[model samples]
Target: MPLVRIKSLPFDHEVPVPQVISALSQAISDAANIEQQHIMVTWEYLAQSHYSHHGQVAANQPINTHPLLIDLIAPNFNTEKQIASMLELIAHTIAEQVPIAKNNIFINFTPAYSDGVYDEGHIVEWDM
Candidate 1:
């Protein structure tokens, strides 16, 4: 399972949040070659006043200055190339679905050992 947490200011009113989440989840599922149901994508909206850039509050700066931060946590089974490809795909998908500039999107990947994750009432164990 892959868990994605997207943090950013609220999106423009033109795009529905649910649509963006669905697109992101689908893109991750496809890039990771995992089942769609295994991917979880969530967005955490940061109030403009709560975010900062270069010591300047987001509310005081241009919206473009605010960055889209993404945290991807998944099993540590993927190769380096696979991880890179997955991040690229997710970034592209976000750019397409949202108004954020591609450069302003940042993704941090954190790999979790299978046994470290608990799901469905038990620890996760990957079948080799």
Candidate 2:
């Protein structure tokens, strides 16, 4: 299953969680063709003060975002590139609503293998 998770490091800003989720999921579903029911988008809140590490400006830093990273496991790994491309729409939608920089939103995709993956409680070949 492909899960979309959003973690925030806001800097002295108060954003509506419902707005973010609504915009993000709509954009993701439209771009990725994943039904709204199947698209699992979740987010966690973090204060600007909490984003600091060793006392640095890393928290809620918009300049450090990467707008491309996607992981789609086989037998659908081929969709990885397309999925990565769709992130921009998601980022842009969020940016329009909030102050999140398009560039600072980084996404990563990983294709998992036989490393503990099973089909219906058993190892079997599946095709759709």
Candidate 3:
């Protein structure tokens, strides 16, 4: 099981949630070599007024300095090179979908033991 959670300032009207989700899932699946069916992507938008950076509210700013957080939980751990490649893919995909600096994107990968991740009441396990 792999869960991808994207957290950022409230999306503007132009930001298409479905497309963003699809792109993220596809990018992650391809980069991580994971099955698309096992990947889950979700997002939560925070009001700019409630999200602050350097003690300043980002509500009225044209470009938010606040970082976009991408949390990924997967059953398998990856090499540092693999993770780096995945992060690059994620940053590019997100930037293409929304207006955010690539440097402001932060992706955290958490590796889950098979026993800890489940789907449809069945625990996740490596096929090979």
What residue pairs clash in candidate 1, if any at all?
none
Model 1 agreement with the true structure over 1-128: per-residue lDDT tens digits: 88889988765455577998998888777666789888999988887588877787765224367778899887798889988887888888888877777788889999989688998889989854
- Can you tell me which runs of candidate 2 are displaced by over 4 Å? 53-55, 58-76, 112-128
* Rank order (by TM-score, best first): 1, 3, 2
Candidate 3 lDDT over 3-58, as tens digits, reads 88998887554678888999889888777778898889998887768877778777
- Candidate 3 RMSD to the correct structure: 2.2
Q: What is the C-alpha lDDT of each candidate?
A: 0.80, 0.57, 0.77
Clash pairs (backbone) in predicted model 3: none
RMSD of each: 1.9, 4.6, 2.2
After superposition of all CA atoms, the RMSD between model 1 and the true structure is 1.9
Report how far residue 20 has shifted in candidate 2, in Å. Answer: 1.4
- Give candidate 1 misplaced runs (Cα > 4 Å): 12-14, 60-63
Indicate which candidate wins on lDDT: 1
What does candidate 2's lDDT look like per residue over 15-53, in tens digits?
786877777777777776766775556777565545654
